[model samples]
Target chain A: MKVLEAETYQAGEVHRFEAAGQEFVYLAPAGGIFGISAAAAAVLETMGAAGRRMDELRAEMRAAGFSAGDVEEALEELIEARVLERPRTLPPPRQKMPERFPLQSLVMNLTNQCNLSCKYCYEYGEDKVATPDGKPKFMDWETAKASVDFFLQDSAGRERLHITFFGGETLMNFPLLKKVVDYAEAAAGAQGRAVDFSLTTNATLLTPAIIGFLADKRIGVTVSIDGPPDMNKLRVFANGRPSYDVIAPKIRELLARHRTRPVGARVTLTAEVTDCIRIFRHLTEDLGFQEVGFAPVTSSQKNLVTIGSGKMDSILEQFCALADEYLAAALENRQHAFSNVTDTIAELHEGVNKSHPCGAALGLVGVGPSGDIAPCHRFVDSDTHKLGNVFTGIDRSKQADFLERGHIDAKYDCHTCWARPLCAGGCHHEAYVRYGDTGHPNLHYCDWIRTWTDKCLRVYGAIAAQNPGFLEHFERRKAS
Target chain B: MKHLRAVNRKAVRVAGEIDAAAADVHALQEGAPPQPKPVPHYPVGCTIVFSPGWEVDSSGGTAGLCQPAERDLYDCYATCFWPAQVPDHLNNYPDWTKKCASATKDWREIDLVFP
Candidate 1:
């Protein structure tokens, strides 16, 4: 039926608030906030939070001490605004989702082998999920090549490819990393394509030659460092020796040498290290890392080390202060070097209506040491949730199961959620650990994300209004 | 479920009776909303920019594809045409004038304070 003035429209999950002394309604599905008049607010109040026929609504407002002229005027404004819509029963798909996985980034677990025995290391931690074989691991040349070949075969034609090296310690299998880089780059070049290389490492084994090689290759590197020595108590070497003193210099060295792409510092926030501002400052200002991102430990193990719900508010409070600093700098047209805030706000600014948290089960796959393919790097060692292996091919049935389960369409709770458009159901890894099911949404962090998103939205609003020119950098970033 | 907090609100040039009523409404609600919110404290000269990976659009959701040109205190819609990915997303906000657009709908308005 064509939308007519007579039709009743139910209010969807809308956020109604008064700001700057004006009544504003945030239509979630439409992603708009309109500053309605006092008369309009009174008209909406007559609607009694439920939608009704315009004629009936007019009568209701009339009964509520409103004149017919006022009611008609409000109706005209509301209908013209499309604010009173036909009551969204179905969420509009934000983007055309890919049916077949267009493989781009393949995380290769070169070796489960590690030189460190950090308390917070997931693979070595209390809640470590064992590989199927239940054996200590390392990827062989054949397995690694098959993983590359699988991405190539399955990649539905892409010009650029990404291969991220992962490990108990990636440098433990430096030879494999070198081989894959050499092989993949050559293959890409042969196909008139290109490849980007990146790796996550402990930074304990960075030799000058290795750093030079990485610098020459222009591969992005993410060093896993928590914070200052006192804060990084959980990140210890195998012999219970402090690894910060060793890695801090390596991080500085990496940042100083790497120029093509910014080297990022990754900090895992646990109960052992909840200091957000200090950690961020130490990494960016002290270590001179170009960017830094933080993540609370997602381990399922019940322990004092796990970041419980109580700590979330405090951590988020500290995070908000830093985000403020980031915003303050942006308003002044200065970069604050806060990668997480920068990244989160970037998505909000772009209107990224995400249908899933990350393209974990979509554009990328994680290859285990033994050549098995899982949904992502976090699930590489899980007995269940394993998609398939490169040796044979992806188990389409299993992949479908994950895709169906992980899609926002399948999450019942997300249907009416205001933040669902962006969050899509937090991280699959977090969901699995927190809820014991990869398909479930990460409920533990829901409030945190919602509040954080609101905070970022406000920051975006302030920046967009204050310094409109600074956003040109976002476009430049894409072109680069 | 949403109520304005009197303490949090800074009475930005609204009429007298309504402002007092808004404060009364807020007082009825329990506790206060989160603090250090995105209240625009920066003055007129502070120029804002887009965060990385984001582009200016006329609207949000499926209709959020129109590229916007940066104006002195706001971003204005440059082209009437929608992005190829969202070819149909044009003039989503019926309440606004034709060329007006915002980064997102989280703001109260899209003027000098939030565009």
Candidate 2:
């Protein structure tokens, strides 16, 4: 018996070895293994042509009564024997994107044009005045129909569609927006699908009429507001005017109009740490919103760029501390509350298996206007991570190739680390944009996970201590 | 009736053993005496022995040297006297007794239903 050991290879590096009278193939980063007997190698050359997912091959082998376990073991043996050529570094190839649960959410970019022109906006550039056509563009009826068609096909015309209106501000194309909603409602009624609509806006365009329409449709709203007016200093228009004051009143109006439906507020934190708690408290207590979350701006834009690594750490610490305080207050007051950081932590703790908690962005595909599909929304703009085009669907043969070549396949400290099962190497987009490679794990993420896990453990321990019979009580309640 | 016959056969086998082991073997050879076998062990709170063919006389039965009344079968192979307690002639072969004890421990207890 020959014992073959597991080996790690860098991206694009190729190594060859033979064992057990068979040739094997291995790819690093993506880490797929395949085996071919000496006699089968000749046939493999012909069969390995282009466009085959490993799943298809595995399925055929499974039908022949070769258990998946045995097939994988043989593949691993081939990998250890060095019969396969390991490629060192390859560009992200087109791999099959997992299409589970069908498509529930669709981001309809109403127009690439924005009113506030926030300094950290992804589309914000020095030549911000010009749209894609060198003029302000809006999604017309036909474009909206086409987008809806794409979504319906993926969803298999399923019920309960979640459509998100995105843009410089989706409200900029109010006429087209109304038309699309009307068309969607009619189409959904005919097809027996229930349509749920939501829009992410700056709130400056949220006039009384707009609020009435949104409230009438029972549409959920998430306004972009970064802390208080002063904290939102960086979020200004092209003329360098702060937009918080102008948007705050409109937000208040919408909140009053749509008090029943949940209103979510998003903040983009910069390096500023002054009065962070007060700002968060004002948003939570004074604004009376149901949920609040934040995403750091990517480092792509010129002005008001994302904070440096050191400052980013400080910012995250401050935000998390503020969130903890807010959550504690909400719990004490018995009020409805939501915090993304805490929610993510709770989810991690509640997961059944220690490994593979939530599906972060593994199978999720984000579609851009050009019909190109990226792994997630974060990498929509980065050409290197584009998996495939939705227009042609996914090219199965190229799926594995894309995954191997993608920046996400790069080496990260998280891969071999124990915390990997939880963090899953952090956000690939953040790693790529911030560290220049997707393979490298973010230390900030590690720090966050460690802090969150510690906090969760402490809370659970305290609860168990206070309520000694909590476990028995909970188990009994569940049993009945 | 068939079970009574089986029990009679077992009694005859015991009678032969008593003839070989007993000091008064010649008396039993002239006129056989009814030999009482030790009761078998059975689980608690259950009727183990049937009437007429077999009956339990004591709880532990024979000072723990013999099987308890609840036992289904009287495992004679497991019964061994202490070397100091038994006659020297019987203690001559220690290995044989040990093998008999192990064999008795391996025996299965089955319930025999009477017609």
What DockQ would you assign to candidate 2?
0.01
- The residue-level lDDT of candidate 2 at A395 comes to 50
Q: Write the per-residue lDDT of candidate 1 for residues B1-115, one digit (tens) a residue.
A: 1121111011121223233333332222212222233431211111232212233222111223333212211222234332221112235533433234443332224322212
Clashing pairs in 1: A466-B47, A466-B48, A467-B47, A467-B48, A467-B49, A468-B48, A471-B49, A471-B50
Interface RMSD of 2: 33.7
Model 1, CA-based lDDT: 0.69
Chain B TM-score for each model? 0.16, 0.17
> What TM-score does each of the candidates earn?
0.73, 0.55
lDDT of 2 by residue, A107-191 (tens): 6666666778676665655322222443225656665776666666667645677777777677888887888788888877788
Q: In model 2 chain A, where is the ten-residue run with the lowest total lDDT?
A: A8-17
> Best candidate per DockQ, number?
1
Displacement of residue B67 (Cα, Å) in model 1 is 40
Model 2 segments beyond 4 Å from truth?
A: A1-101, A125-136, A157-159, A188-191, A273-275, A300-304, A308-320, A323-333, A336-338, A352-374, A378-412, A416-422, A436-440, A460-480, B1-115
True contacts kept of each: 0.00, 0.00
